[model samples]
Target: MHGCFWHRHPGCPKATTPATRPEWWQRKFDGNVERDRQQMDRLIAAGWRVGIVWECALGRKADGALIDRVEAFIRHGRDLRAEWP
Candidate 1:
């Protein structure tokens, strides 16, 4: 699992580009996203289950159900996804 901004988690509030330097921020963010994608791809290909748990998904309201989703991915290799309702 990874943080939203650093890993470019979809729909994350913190994943926004800085307004002051839009171009630079976009490039940097794009690179971060690309790197994460490549890393996930490699891990999956190597038989390791990988996932991204966005920060937004860990909000107060979603606390209880998150564990269930994580357990499912870890135990059964079910689709590794966790997001806010």
Candidate 2:
């Protein structure tokens, strides 16, 4: 599971920048995004299926739909990449 802020989850409210040290935070976030991309690329090249479950998707409640989606992905997903909402 990846934190929306650290992983730079697009359109996520949790992905916010701190008021202080904006430049430093940007650099850190950029590096994190780049590293994640590189690792994902390597995994894909090695014929591994990749699935990313964002923190926002896991709410306080136990969502049946989310669990089902994850189960489906694990059991029968054939795509190169899959990400949760």
| TM-scores of all candidate predictions against the true structure | 0.78, 0.95
Structure candidate 2, residue pairs in collision = none
User: Candidate 1: minimum summed lDDT over ten consecutive residues — where?
Assistant: 76-85
Q: What are the per-residue Cα lDDT tens digits for candidate 1 across 1-85?
A: 5677777766667776667988887888889889887887888788776766777667667466777867676788655433332
lDDT of 2 by residue, 1-85 (tens): 8899999999999999999999999999999999999999999999998999999999899999999998999899988889999
What count of clashes does model 1 give? 0
Residue 64, model 2: lDDT of 99
* Most accurate candidate by TM-score: 2
Candidate 2 residues lying further than 4 Å off, grouped into runs, are none
Candidate 2 clashes: the total is 0
Assess candidate 2 and give its lDDT: 0.95
